[model samples]
Target: MDDKTRVPSEITPDQWTWNVKVDPPFHKKHFNANLVKYHDRVMGQDKLRVFVPLCGKTLDMIYLSERGHGVVGLEFSQIAIEDFFAENDLTYDSEKLDGKPFVRYAARENNITIYQGDLFDLSSEVCGDFDASWDRGSFVAINVSTRAKYGRLMSNLIKPSGKILMELYQYDLAKCTGPPHYAEEKDLVENFTEFQVRMLSEFVVVDSPPYYSGDDFQLGVALLSH
Candidate 1:
């Protein structure tokens, strides 16, 4: 949807928390290929600190951790965090952040930590900073009106020289409304004005899975840096 026609009601943390419990189709049990393909290109460091936004029970966090990168995920759902640990057979210790609206869960043996709370409530003080960030599908999943805010939050969470690896879905706005919104090139540039944006790859698909369907849907992979 375009700026003028975009709806203003952003989905709340409670809504997302509830959605994950129902086994939403968007929840993937495997690592996203796009992430693995672009990992080295987008994230140059082997042992880096990485931030993941709107991270569900994604196996990507484990994938990154296994490769020696420290991963910190910001998610809104306690259910999702619990599932991630249970499915992976990882034991974790939980505690609430002193002044923040989040509970932190850190794996005992891995360099993976997850903060469960509203993304809007996260700050640099609470999350610290990272060398890189990954947005597997979060940019498109959030409301359009909050995109700028989200971008700023990401910018703040990373170091000045940090990089961002993002995956986006693009489609004809007239055909559908989206949780997976149509994030065009211009939208990416505008939202991440502080960074140098590059379109790594893009392709059109006709027969997407039921979770993402469109006649001429586009999938885009991009890398951004300050």
Candidate 2:
């Protein structure tokens, strides 16, 4: 569709389904490097455990695993977890809990494990204490109305000294209202208060994945210290 309707849900049914369907490729095409760069800087050579909230076949997991960091990815959609392994040509074993399956992919002799289930339903024990967090489009997926709840959950679950590297969409109020929801600087700093904000910068980048545009969109990357 057009730029104005690029936001999810507002887009047509086929487009919406396609968006969900091609998550793996979409992440690679659009935002993979940004994640790698951010994580590499924050996580360093510590071999620390990394958490990807609302992970949807994100290439970042592969990047982190390759760099000797352990990965724990949380996803609500089974399709997404399956697609991630399939698309990467990685094989994994599965365990079913309450009729839902959680697929585990271990790398580096079983250091990294990708867990699948409703993000809301996952426990800290399942996710483990993360040294760092990678948030690509996860936050924006929640409606603005529920963002506070999302923030509170993040605060409660995340390790106190851990860091979160997040990407946020900032829209011009007149042009768009979103699922790539608009979030301002104040909101982020306020919402993530328990953690000190280390970095927050805005850049104009292609909105790939859901927004496949050559035109620039405002993207925010913030590093949090708890």
Candidate 3:
């Protein structure tokens, strides 16, 4: 496959059906520190609806739901979603969307619902508007060509008063072709002009994921608000 077409979807056909090496191959078993550390600033409101895009069975959903916040997650992998519930020992009811590739999974024990399908398939009316968005790996996972579409969806889902806490990697992109693609300041400005972007902090990625170049790679934490 050409460089542009190399993406997350291409890994799936072999990953679940056969043995394939994929970056961060297993579903994450722990909470993302960016979410926990910036909790008060990003998701301070109680019972607020939070959107988690490209969520790979992240434990942050449990963290949010337990704190009385509603969590909505979008993921393309059914295997990952099922593994999440099974590994976490959570019971959920499932419903297939009519004429859609998505199957909705609602956790019976918490205020968490996950939509299993392509992230691009989501719409505000379908997933509902969110007061806050926690984008751990979502935005960076987006291919540069499709970032505009992703930004448009965020525009629709994010309320005027909503906030978005995001984590991204900053590095030399040409050398390291990535699913967790490197993002620049101009990229965000061009795609998400409706919101004000602020770089909160930067920390060295310790034990950096295999996808990264591992040469002093840094993780950037940012907050976006309308």
Give per-model TM-scores: 0.91, 0.78, 0.86
Worst 10 residues of 3 by lDDT: 12-21
Between candidates 1 and 3, the TM-score winner: 1
lDDT of 3 at 69: 90
Itemize residue pairs with steric clashes in candidate 2: 207-211
The local distance difference test score of each candidate is: 0.82, 0.66, 0.77
- Look at candidate 1 and give me any clashing residue pairs: none
Once fitted onto the true fold, the runs of candidate 2 whose alpha carbons sit more than 4 angstroms away are 1-26, 29-31, 98-110, 205-216
lDDT of 3 at 39: 92
Residue 27, model 2, lDDT: 52
lDDT of 2 by residue, 1-226 (tens): 1344444333221232324434434355344766756655788778877888877777778788888877888776667667777777777776665544454555334455777656665666555577778888777766655567767778767788888888876654445555567665666777776777755566556554454343545776888787
Worst 10 residues of 2 by lDDT: 9-18
Go through the candidates in order and give the clash count of each: 0, 1, 0
lDDT per residue as tens, model 3, 125-179: 6877999999987888767678888888898999998988988776554446665
